[model samples]
Target: MFTTRPEIAGTFGCVSSTHWIASQVGMAVLERGGNAFDAAAAAGFTLQVAEPHLNGPLGDCPIIVHDAATGAQRVICGQGVAPAALTVEHVRGSLGLELIPGTGLLPAMVPGAFDAWATLLRDGGTWTLGEVLEFAIGYAARGIHYVPRICATVQTMRPLFEAEWPTSAALWLRDGGPQPNRLWANPALADTYRRVVREAEAAGSDRVAQIDAARRAWYGGFVAEAIGRFVAENEVMDASGERHRGVLTAQDMANWRAPVEAPVFLDYGNTRILKCGTWSQGPAMLQTLALLRGFDLGALDPMGERFVHLVVEAMKLAFADREAFYGDPDHVAVPLQTLLSDGYTDARRALIGEEASLEFRPGSPDGIAPRTDYAAAVERARAAHEAAGSGEPTVSRLGASGGDTCHVDVVDRWGNMVSATPSGGWLQSSPAIPELGFCLGTRGQMFWLDETLPNGLRPGRRPRTTLSPAMALRDGVPWMAFGTPGGEQQDQWQPIMLLRMLHHGFNTQQAIDAPAFHTEHWVSSFWPRGARPGKVVLEGRYDLGVAKALQARGHLVEMGGDWTEGRLCAIRREADGQILAGANPRGMQGYAVGR
Candidate 1:
């Protein structure tokens, strides 16, 4: 079969990521006999240096790891929570704002990526704290030949940096923000990493103790002090970004740590797919799978109009439920078991008709009423039609503020594997802290100000985030690790890749290189939230007849450039012990490397 690139084949190890440098760094760790956890941690830190516009140290990550030694699959919750002082009254009453701004300081949350990587290294790997971070520190101190996309983003944000955020301008606005031809270096970031290492080594040579010391340095010591001062001194913002003070503090950062928990999973045929809990949009994928099992997926052509229609219709239902019920289970009671029960899934599946659904139909699982602010939703949708866009998209520029996410997948020779999606704290997300050379993320924008819904903004509550990673088990053993870097589009692309592999006999690269599609029918997860009913965008490589067929069925179809959809990276270990990997070829940026 023809593909954009050959499926990488090996028995030793495999690593795939949104950026080539991160993948190479992960492979370097594996070559040195580090486990998958160590490799993933190394790669994760390198991503912050290599793709500063896409992710940073202060961002969030949700990781799924399959450990062969314990015969277990575990999830590390790298997602952060809102500040204890960021109450609904503070936003809606005192700030006199109905919605949080997409940019600026008000939407900042406790950063979780750094601690998450440290936790993984401590609990699962044999590498030292200083060893994994060395790669990222080297790139920052010397120089990196960055891609045009990063250069473009820095230039675009230069004005905002120069005008309102002088500290950011000091770093990013120099020489028009890293020229496309020259290598750019971040000396401040390098020094920051070096100082952390010094603090870790001060705790003695024991590996676990050193890792714990580094965590303290971030959350309680120098890093936290810098963030606390910066946020406390800054002003809060409305949608217009003009007034108020930031609520984040050192106390919030110190109070939080990345949590590890068992993942919820479903087994269909010989494959068992696992995802994070209802706190994320992950369960929506499981819901789609439960709904699709009744269909004769094998009989339908995976590339034809029929397959696209069935998948899209099923996704609409699943996402509708996501908006209605999914949230941080610690604060709210999410009916997950009822939502995934055989009776509820089959009943919901019966709603997919030949005609498209223009209505937002959220189901009533267990006879519970779906609580939502419909009146406010309609108003927000209308304002969205007028407001210029804002959110995380991979384009050179988008909306009021623009940024994207990053993904890494690694499989080691020891039968260990990891799939992680790390994102937020982009260059445009907020102004940088002068001392640390990074800023906080705007994931708090995902919370509803209504204070009544499951995803409402509450102090110390986790916002319903779009950052999701995925893993799969074949028969009773671990097999695939894969994910992508699109906000709502993360889960959409993976299921299609899996279906093709499961039924059409497509290899890893073939599945990743195929045409992709997704719906934009739900409420926006970013600022100026909007809803576009029955809208679908398909990669133009798919047949024109498929688009026309969908339009005839009352679906609004728009054609995108053949490569405009998603950037997915995947790696799998076969029962024969052969390792295979694949990366998206759309932008010619993502790389899959292995021996």
Candidate 2:
């Protein structure tokens, strides 16, 4: 079997991320005696600089960390909440919109990535805030080679920015709109981080105190002030095709903080899969796993038509539940236990037929009726999504897709591990805050305007985000941390890697290198959500016979380019202290480094 690259192996540490620069930064942190937590923070911040179109300082992240010292695993909820002033009534009555816009300040939530990384550093890391942020600051100040995709994204939105977002035009088009593969600098963003470092240094010499000070500077101090002013002054265009002012205020930033919580996990034989709560799309993967547990997956070929069809059908059922039930658990009584219960999974599993089902079927849990007009909503969203004519290179068939996301995985010699997906805050998401050099994230676009649904827009409610990262423990020990960067396809790409590793005896690189596929058969989480019934998009690497066979079973099969499916990355730590890492070769960006 041909492999894109050898699995990186090391005795000290390993790092894998969506960008080579970020992976190198993580390795540098480990080489400098930082733990996995510190390395992850460094890599994560660096990703914001290296892949600015994919993510930025104002994005959100859901991080899963495994501490080898205490043998504990925890989830840091980096997803920000809706503003206290934002409500469904306001969007519908005041803004005269059916759904929250996918771009502009109206969809901005309190920036959460900075606080989450700071929290990780404060609690589990061994380095100062200054140390972890140095790479990002340097890259932003001195400039780094821009990815071609970044140039393309900027070009696509150039007219919009020039006409409606002067601040964005000034920043992105400063040098005649950043040339592809050319070095580009964001001095304002660099200064923003530098100011935070200065504020932290002013606090004290204690590392923990410095981290806390940085957090304060971000959420309550200068950064917050700038963001507040930008939103208040700007009325920008969004997915609704109308200009609207944001309700997010400086007080919201001051009132909000990232919280660390327990991860939801499922025991599958000897492996335990961990993910964030229902506030994210993480649990859908677990639900899919539960549905898959009753089947003899080991008996089937990993890439066979039967296996692909089964996984795709199971995902559709799981995502339907996601649309109907998944939300911020703090605000709603998510029947999580019931949804994951054996009986519930059994009922949902039975719905998967040999012939692909095109209808959206959200199971009735706890006697609660699933949303009656979900298909109608999907059609509306599909119309808008198609009209927008916007999509990233991968997973474009669904959603108001513009910017993508990024992922990072790290493991240290001490067995500390972290898996994080950081996204939102694309340059095209909103006008750049001139003072900050980054735009607000439009994550609130995931919130529906329908008050009847679980993910309805409400004051202070967290959006049901699509960003999900995964961690797995084998025999009560940290084993693997993995994730990717697709909006609704995040969970779709994960199971393939896991199934291959679990059933086919594939190594990390081999599993990641395998062809991948996903179904766009559910309502997307992004703006102008779209659903293509019975649509199965597969990489061309898959056997042609399999594609024909899937079509024979009622799937609307579409063949994507070989190596176009996923940018998955993974890192594993053995009990005996060996580290192995792998990265997707697709897009020619992701890399894994170890020594």
Candidate 3:
């Protein structure tokens, strides 16, 4: 079997990301003596510049970090929370709105990516805030290649900018917008970084103090002030097909900070897989593993219908539980222990049949009946999704259909590792803030309007997000850091690759290179939330017979472009100190660099 690229191996360090430039920047950081945390942060900020159509400064990021010396692993919760004023009564009763608008100011959460990176850098990195930030600042101030996707996404939002978002129009519409492969820059965003660094440096020379001060500058000072003013001042059109102002405020930003918490993990044989807490959909992969443990997966061909169908069925069950049980642990009593308990998984495993199951099933956790408030609407949406051609990839589905995401993975010589997925605040997500040069994220759109459900829209509760980053430890030691950028497909694709790598004896690149698939049977986490009961998007690289076999088993299979499935990046620390890495080749932009 052929692989897209060689699995990068080195003893020094390795960094992989969705964009090549960001990957190189992370490698440079490691070469300059920074740890995995520092390298990830540098790459993340650079991605905001180079891949603005995918992520922005105000986007959310969930990071999994392992410190080799202490042998401790933690997750940085960069997913922001809804505003205090954003309540069911406010939207439904006061505004006469049924659902949270998927775009514009109303759905803006307290932007969380900045503080999340700050916490990572302050806790584990050896670099200063200015040092980690300089890479992004350079690209934003000077220039970087404007990819075609970025140009097209901008064009899609052109009408919105011209009509209402004057600031965005002025910023992006300059020089007839940006042509593909042309050098483009965002001076306003660069100046924002400079002001942040200046204010942070004014606090003194201590590196840790500067990181903290920089956090303050974003959440409490200039960045917050500008964002609050813009959201309060503008009432813009959104996915609801209506105009509305935001509920987010400067106080919301000031009151919020990213928290680092112990990660949730499951022991699958000798492998201990770690994921973010219930606040994210990360544990869905863990749940999938728990369910898959009952099967003899190693006995099946990974590329065969048996494997794909089994995995797809398992994911539908896992994601069903995601919608029913996963939420902010801070806000609800998520019976996580029971959700992953042997008894529960054993029951879930029993539900999988030789044929694909179209029924939406979420098992009872601790005898509590799972509640999906919009369950009735799911079928109607399923039809609509089919009629609307649900198989289209995210970027093509832009403007409220959905926006894309980015991922990064890094491992240092000391064995410290980081896996992060950063997303939201796409140029199409909302209007740009003129002063700050970025828009607020639309993560609040993920919350359901019904207060009875676990993921209902509530004041200050973090939306049950789909931004998941993952890692795995072997024999009680940190080993691999990996993640992808396909929204609900994140966990699905991750487990498939892990299964291939662990069971089929495939290398990292080979596993990533294999044909991938994911189910949209569960309700989407984005705007116009919908589900296609038996829909599975399969990469066309798979044998055509596999598609026929799946369809015979009742799967509503959609054959996607051969190279249009996932953009995963991964890095692993081998037992003998060798660092191995792999990046997705589908997009022709992802890269792995080391040595």
Cα shift from native, residue 234, model 1 (Å)? 1.7
Per-residue CA lDDT of model 2 for 224-279, tens digit only, reads 99998888887887766677899899999999999899999998889999999999
Candidate 3 C-alpha lDDT tens digits along 402-457: 58899999999988999999998888888899888888889998898887678988
lDDT tens per residue, model 1, 359-444: 88889998978875545665677765654355432122221555789999999998999999999988778878877878788888
Clashes counted in candidate 2 amount to: 0
Residue 196's lDDT within candidate 1 is: 95
Q: Quantify all predictions' global Cα lDDT against the true fold.
A: 0.87, 0.89, 0.89
Worst 10 residues of 2 by lDDT: 392-401
Residue pairs with clashing backbones, model 3: none
* RMSD to the hidden true structure, all candidates: 2.4, 2.5, 2.2
TM-scores, all models, native as reference: 0.97, 0.97, 0.97
* C-alpha RMSD (angstroms) for model 2: 2.5
Ten-residue segment with the worst summed lDDT in candidate 1?
A: 390-399
**How many residue pairs clash in each candidate at the backbone level?**
3, 0, 0
Off by over 4 Å in 2: 385-401
Question: TM-score of model 2 relative to the true fold?
Answer: 0.97
